[model samples]
Target: MKPLLLEIGTEELPVGALPGLAQALFDGVVDGLVKRGVAIERDDAKPLYSPRRLAVLLPGVAAEQPEQRSEVLGPYVNIALDAEGQPTRALQGFAAKAGVDWTRLERTTDNKGERFVHRAVTPGAATAALLPEVLAEAIAGMPIPKPMRWGTRDSGFARPVHWLVLLHGEDVVEAALFGVRSDRMSRGHRFMHEGPVWIAAPGDYVDALRAAHVLVDPDERRERIVREVREAARAVGGVARVDDGNLEQVNCLVEWPDAVTCSFDEEFLAVPAEALVATMETNQKFFPVLDEGGRLTPHFIGVANIESKDPAEIRKGYERVIRPRFADARFFFEEDLKQGLASMNEGLRTVTYQAKLGSVADKVARVAALAESIAPKVGVEPALARRAAELSKADLQSRLVNEFPELQGIAGRHYAAAAGEPAEIAAAIDEAWMPRFAADAIAPSPLGRTLTIAERLDTLAGGFRAGLKPTGNKDPFALRRNALALARTLVEAGIDLDLDAALEAAGADVAEVREFILDRLRHYYAEQGVPPQQFEAVAATHPQSPADFDRRLKAIAEFALLPEAEALAAANKRIRNILRKAEGAIPQRVDAALFAEDAERELAEAVDAAIADTDTALAQRDYVAVLGRLARLRPQVDAFFDQVMVNADDPAIRGNRLALLQRLADRLGSVAAIEHLSS
Candidate 1:
C-alpha cells in the first residue's frame, strides 16, 4: 500500500467552474476505486485545486482489487439431456466451453429445473496496472461547461492539458490523457517559478510547490490572500471588506498572491459608496476599504498573482485602471440626482417588467395600491407607503442602475434621500428589495415591511395569473424565492397579515396563491427543526395568517412534548376516522339524555365544562393552553372508547354517539389537527 497523487495541469480554468471541476474529479476517482474494492486509507480525504490545476492526494490506497469471481449458466436439464437419459451434444458443448469433461460438469437447480453452470475465480490485477483506466474514467466524468479541443486531438476538456502527474509513493504510475503521459513533475507558479518542480512522492507534492512560490492548497492560499489584504488595508488606515464571493473569485484568479493598496481620486467619493464599492468589488475583484463607520474609504486593496519587486507600479496600474469606471459612476450619480425620482419614474413607462405582466409602470401602480391597502394593518400611514411604493422601481431607469443592475434599490434609496424625501420613505424604497437572496434579513422598518409584502403580493398574483408558475427547476420569474421571502417577512418580522385577503386585494387567485405561499413554510419550518407532522397539524387547520400559522405551529410543537399528548393524538385520530366513515348526518349538539353508557355521559359533561375554558384560550389565540386543556380529557376519552360501542344498534343512540365525537373533534382541531401527530 502507498499514498497516491494525481494532478491535471491546464490553462487557467474558468473562475466559476474551477472548484466544481476539482470536486467532480475527486469524487469520480475515489468512487471508481472504492466500487472496485480498493480500500482508501482515509474517509475525510478532499480534493485540492488552484487556477491552473486540479489535484487529489490520498494518504494510502489498496495495492490491488479484491479477488475476481464469476458464474455462468448454460442450457437447462431438458435441453442438455435426450430421451435416452445419456450425455447429449449440448452437454458436451457446454462442458467444452468450461474446459471440463461432461461427467465432471456441475449442475445447479433453477426455475427451469436443473441447469449446467460454470464457476471461475481469477487473481485481482495490481493497482498500478488499473491506474490508467481509473484515471481515464475520472477524466471522462469532469463537469466542464464548455469543453475545448486543442491541437490535433479529437478529445476535449475545459482547457488543453499541459501535463499529467500520477505518482504512487516514489514510483510514477503509468497513465496518459490528452496525449500527455503521467510523470512525477509538476509546474509551479507561472511567473515566480520558471521551471517544473520534481515531486519525489505523494507526501512531498504540496511542500515542493509551496517552495516554488505556488500555494497548491486553495484554503492556505485563500487565507494568505485575506491576511495580506487586511495588512495592506491597515497600512492605509482602513479595514478591507472581503466578502466570501469576491474572495473566492480572486482566489481562483491567482496561483501566488500579494495585496496592493491603491487609491482613487477624492472627487469620486461624492458618489454613493455602494456604486463605488460595486465598481471595485464586482468589476475589478478588489476589496474596498472601510472606516470604523463601515463606510467605504478612498483606498482599495487589489490582490495580484505575482509578488512584484516594484509593487508601487502595480498599485499605480490598479488606480489608473479604476479611474474611468469611477468617473462614469460619478457622472451617472450626478445626472440621476438632477433628474430626481419623479422624472425617472417616467422612463419606467417605456420599459417592460415582464412580457405577460405589462410594463414596469403598471407593476408600480399595482404595487402602490397594494401597499396602501396593507399599510393600515401594519400601523403605517397609507399615504407614506403609497409614496414609497410609487417610486420603488424608479431607479430601474437610472444610468447608475443600468451600469450596476445590482444597485436597483440602493440607488433609489440614495436618490430619494437626496430629493428630500422623508427618512422612512427613503429607507422603504430600498427596504422593499430586502432579503435580496436567501439567508438575508427581512425589511427592518414597518413601512419597508409593508412595501415588501405588497410588492411581492402583486408579483405573485401577476405571475400565477399569467401562467408563470414554476415547474421543475424552471423559475424564470423567481416566484419561489419571492414566495419564500414574502412568507419569511411575515413570520420572521412578526408582520401579522391575512394572506388570503392580501392575495385577493392584489388581484390574485386567493386559494392558489395562498397554498403556494404556505407551502414554502414546509421548508421554513423544517429548517427551524419543527417536525413534519407538527407542521402538517397546523397547516391542516388552514390558518389565514402567517404569524398565526407560526404561532399555532409553535404551540403544537410544545404540546407534542406533554405526557398525555400521545394518547390524545391517538384518540383524535380514532374520532376523525369514525366521523369520516359515519353513515348518515350527525347531530350538531350531543344529546346527553340519549346517552346509554356512563362513560359517554361523563365525557359529555367534561366537554361542556372544558368548552368555556377552551373558548377563552382560543379567543386569546393561546394555542398551548387550549391543547393542554384538551389533553386533560384524555382519560375520559379513553374510557368512553374502551367502555362504549359508538356503533350502537339503536338508531337514536348511534346518532347521539357520532354527534358526541364530532363535538370533540371540532374543539380538539380548533388550533391544529392533532390527529396528524398520531403515528
Candidate 2:
C-alpha cells in the first residue's frame, strides 16, 4: 500500500468560497473511496485548504477491493414454471435480468406463501479499477455553494481548474474534473513560484506545496500571519494592533502572509474614532493603530500577499485610499450635527417603516404608547418609558446613521445627549436595540427594557400584520430577530407581562403573532443550550408569555431531580385519565364528606396540601419547593389508585373521587401537563 495525493489548482478563488470547496472535495473523495470498498487509513488522509487550491492526501490506500457475494431476487416460482413442470419465459427473463443462467436459479418460499427464484454469485473488480468512475461521479455532483463559469467551458464551479494532481500509490489515476484532466502534477503559488510540481505520493503532498511557497495548513498560515504582524508592529516605535476580525479575513485571503506597517495623518483622528476605524477596517481591510494607553492612534497595519522591498511604499498606498473615505465621514458627521437631534427626529416622519404599516414616525408613536401601557407592569415610570420610546428611533434620520447604517442606535444615544436630553432618555435610545444577537446582553434598566420590548413588539406586530413572516431563511423584515429580542427581554426582566395582551395593546392586527413568538422562544431556548424535549415541555405548559415558558422550564428542571418526581408524574397521568373519563364538566371542589373510603379521604387531604404548597412555591417562583410538595403526595396517590375504585358503583362516591383526581390534574397542569411528557 502507498499514499495517494490530489490537488485541484485554480485561479485565485474568493476567500468566502474556500471553506465549502475544501470540505466538499475532501468529503466527496472519502465517500467515493468508501463506496468503492477502498479502506483508507484514518491517519493517512489529510486535507489542506488554501484560497487558490484544494488538496487531499490519502496515505496507505488499499490497491484493490475485497471480493463479495450478493443475492438477487427473481420471479416467483409459480410464474417461472408452467403447469407441465417445465421452465417458462418468465424464468429466462428473470435469469437474464439477474445476469445469470436459468440453471443457476434457486427457489425459496417467501412470507406470502409464494415460492420465489433467486440467484447468488460473487462480484469481481479491483478497488483501484473502480476509483476513477466513482470519483468522477462524486466530483461532478459536488455541492458548491456558489459556482462560476470561467474560460470557454459553460460548466460552473467555484473556480476554473487549471491543473489536477491525481496519484494513487505512485501510479497516475487518469481522471477528469470539470473538463480539466488529472495526473500526478500540481501547481504552486501563482505569484512566487512558476512550475509544474510533481507529487511523488500522498506523503509528499504537504512538503511539495511548502517547497513551492505555499503553506498548506490553514492554522499554520494564520499563526504565521499573527506572529509576523506582532513582530512588525514591535519593530516600529508606534505600537500596531491588528483587529481580530480583519485578521480572520486576512487568514483566508492568502496562503503566505507578510505583515507591513502603515501610517496616516494624525488629523484623521479629528473625525470620530468610529469613522476612522471603519474607514480602515471596512474599506482597506487594515488594522487600526493604538497608543500605549489603548486609545486608537492614526497608524494601521495591513497584511499583504507579498513582502515589498520598501514597506513605506505600501504605507503610502494605504494612506492614499483611506484618506478620502475618512474625509467623507467627517463631512457627514458635521453636516448631521448641524441639523441637530430635534430636526433629525422631525425628519423621521418622512421615513417609511413599512408602506402598509405606516411611517417610522407612526412606529415611534405606537412604541411610545405601548411602552406607557407596559410601564406599570414592568415597574418603570410611565413617563420615562414614553420618553425613551420617543428618542429611540430619532437617530434613524441622523446623517451619521445614514452614512453608517450599522450605527443607528449608537448615533441616537450620542445625538440625544448632545441635545441635552435627559440621561435616561439618551441611554434608552441606545438600549432599545439592547440585544442585537441571541446571547447579547439585554437592557439592564427597567425603563430601557420597557422601551426595548415596546419598540420590538410594535415592529413585530406591524410586520406580521402585513404578512411579512420569515420562512426558510428569508426574514427580510428581521421579524425573527425582533421576536427573539422580545422573548429575551421578557425573560431577563423577570416580568410576567402577558404577551397576547401586550400585542393587543400594541395594536394586534396579526392573529399568528403568539405562534410566531412561540417558535422564536424555541429558537431562544435552543440558543441557551436547552434540550428540545425540555423546551417543548415548558412551552406546552406556558404558551402565553415567554417569561412563563422560562418559569415552566425552571419547574421542569427542579421536578426532574425529586426522588419520586417520575412516579408523581405517573400518578398525575392516572388522575388525568380518571378526570378525562368524567367528561367535560370538571369539578372545582372536592367533597370530602362524600368520600366513602379511607383511601379517598387520604387522597383528598394529600391533594389539598400539595395544591397549597404548589401555589405558594409558584407565587415565590420556587419551583423546587413545588416539586418537593408534589413528590410527597405521590405515595398517597398511588395508594388511592391501588385500594379505591375511582368509578365506584355509587355515583356520589365516584364523583367525589373524580373531583379529588381533578384537583391533582389542575395542580400538575399548572407546571406542565404530564400527558405531554414523553419517556
Candidate 3:
C-alpha cells in the first residue's frame, strides 16, 4: 500500500460553496478508486481545502488492482458434438474466440446438460500507470455551480486553475488537469509566502503547508478561528457569538486566520441588535460579541487572513469598514422610529404578496381574521391576537428590514415596542415567524402561537389556491415548509383547534390541504424516531386536529411495544379483511341468541366491556389508556377467530358472526388503524 495526495490550486473559489465542493471532490476520488478495483481505507482519507485550493489525502491506498479474471459459457455438449462425436461449426467458433483448441476448453455440468466454458486471467497493471485516468475522472465530475474559464482555455471550472499536485509515496505521479501538469511544487499563502513550496511526500503535506503560513486542513483552521474569536471576545469582557455559518464562511475566506477585536460607537447599540448583527455578520462576516445575558455588545470580532505586525492598523481598518454600515443602520432605526410602525402598513396595500393571492394587505387581513377566530379557543384574547396580526407584516416596509431582509419579524418586534404596544404583543409580532427554519424553536407564548398558526394557515391556503404546491423539489412558494411549521406549532403547542375548519375558513380545499400538511409529518416523525407504521396507523384515522394526531400517534407507538401488540394487530387485520369480503350486508348489531360457539359469545362480551371501559377516555382523546384497555381483548379475539367459522351455512348465523367481527374492527380502529402495524 502507498499514501496518495492530490491538490488542485485555483483562484479564490466561492466561499459559501467551498465546503460542499471539497466534499464532492473527496467522495469522487474515493468512488473512482473503488470502482477501479483499488482497495483503500476510507477512514484514513481526509479532504483539505481553503479559498485557493482543494486537496485530498489518503494514508493507505492499494498499489495496484487485483488480478482480473472472466469466464464465458459456450454451447451445450449436445450442440457442440454431433451424433458422430465430431466438432461442429459452433464449437470451432467458440474455440476461435477463446484463442484455444476446442479440446482444451473445460466442461461444466448443469441441470440441463454439459456445457463448454472459457476461463481467462491477466495480471493487474501498476497503480502509477492508472493514476492519470483515475485522477482525471475524479476532477471532471466536480460540482461547480458556475464554472469559469480563464485565459484561452476551452473548458471552465469553479475558478481558474493555476497548479496541480499529485504525489504517491514520495514519488511524483504524472497526471494533468485543466492545462496544467501534476508536480511536487505547491504555492503558499498569496501574501505571506512569495515562492513555491516543495512537497516531498503525501504524508508531509500538512506540515509543509503550515511552514508556508497556510493552514490547509479546514478543521484545524475552523477550530483556531473559534478559539481566537472566543479569546478576543473575553479580552473585551464579553462572549462572541461564533455561529457555524459565519465561522464556515470565514474559514473558507482565509488561509491563516487571526481574530481582532473591533467596536463601534455605543450610540449604534440603540438600533435593534438583530439589524446591527446582520450588518456585521451577513454583510461583513464579523462575529458579534454579546453580554452574559445574551444581549448584544458594542464590541465585535473580525477574522483577518493574516497576522499583521501592526495589529492595531488591522483593527482600525476593520472599524472603518463597519462604521458606515452601522451608521446607516442607526439612521434607518431613527427614521423608522419617527415614522412609527402603524404607518408601515399603508404601503403594504400596494405591495403584492402573490399574483394570485392579491396584495400584502390582503394576506395580513386573512391572517388577522384567522388569528382572531382561533385565539379564544386556544386561551388568548381575540383582540390582542388580531392587533398583533395587523402589525405582523408591517415591518416589511421599514428601512431597517429593507436593508436586512432576514429581520422581517424581528424588526416588527422592535418597532412595536418602540411604538408603545404591549410587551406580549411586541414579542408575539416576532414570534409569529417562529421556527423560521428546520432547527428553529416554535412560539412559546399563547398569543404568539395563535399568530403563528394563523399566518401559516393563511400562507398555505394562498399557496395551494394559487397552484404553487411543491412537486418533487420545486417548491417556489415554500408551502411544504409552511405546512410542516403549521403542523409543528399545533402539535408542539398542544393546541387542538380543528385544522379542517380553519382551512375551510381560509378558502382552501380542506381535504387536500389537510392531507398535504399531514404528509410532511412523515418526514417530521422520521426524525423524531417514530416508525412509519405507527405514524401511518394514526394518519389512517384522519384526525382533523394535529394535536389529536399527535396523541394517537404516541398511543400507537406505545401500543407497538406491548407483549400482546403483535397478536392483537394481526387479529385486527384478519377481522378487517374478513369484514371487507362479506357477501351480504354485515349487520351492525349481534343477536345474543344466534351465537353458536362459546368463543363467539366470550369475544362479544369482552368487546362490550372494553368499549364501556374506554368510552370516557376515548371522548377525552386519552388514546394511550384507550389502547391499553383494547389490548386486553387480544385473548378473546384470538380464540374467537380460531374457533368460529365466519362463513357459516346458516345465513342468520353467518351475518351474526360477521357483525361480531365488524364490532371488534370498529373498536380496534377507534384509537388508530392498528392493522397497519401488523406487517
| TM-scores vs. true structure, each candidate | 0.95, 0.92, 0.96
Candidate closer to the true structure by TM-score (higher is better), 1 or 2: 1
Per-residue lDDT of model 1, residues 553-617, tens digit only: 98998899999999999999999999999998998878878999999999998888788888988
Residue runs of model 1 more than 4 Å from their true location after superposition = 73-80, 87-105, 108-116
TM-score of 1: 0.95
Give the alpha-carbon lDDT of every model: 0.91, 0.77, 0.91
Q: For each of the candidates, give the backbone clash count.
A: 0, 1, 0
Query: Candidate 2, overall lDDT?
Result: 0.77
Ranking by TM-score: 3, 1, 2
Instruction: Quote the positional error of residue 175 for candidate 3 in Å.
Output: 0.8
Among all candidates shown, the one with the greatest TM-score: 3
* Residue range 1-679, candidate 3, lDDT tens digits: 8888989999999998898888888988888888878888767566899999999999888888899888999999999999998889999999999999999999998999899999888887778888888877776888877799888988888999999999878889888788899999998999999899899998899999999999999989999999999999999899999888888889999999999999989988888899889988889999999999999998999999998999999999999999999999989989999988889988899999999999999999999999999999789999999999999999999998898889989999999999999999999999999989999999989999999999999989899999998899899988999999999999998898899999998989988998899888888999999998899899899886898899999999899999999999999998888888899798879999999999999999999999999999999888999999999998898898789899999999999999988888998999899999998
RMSD of 1: 2.1
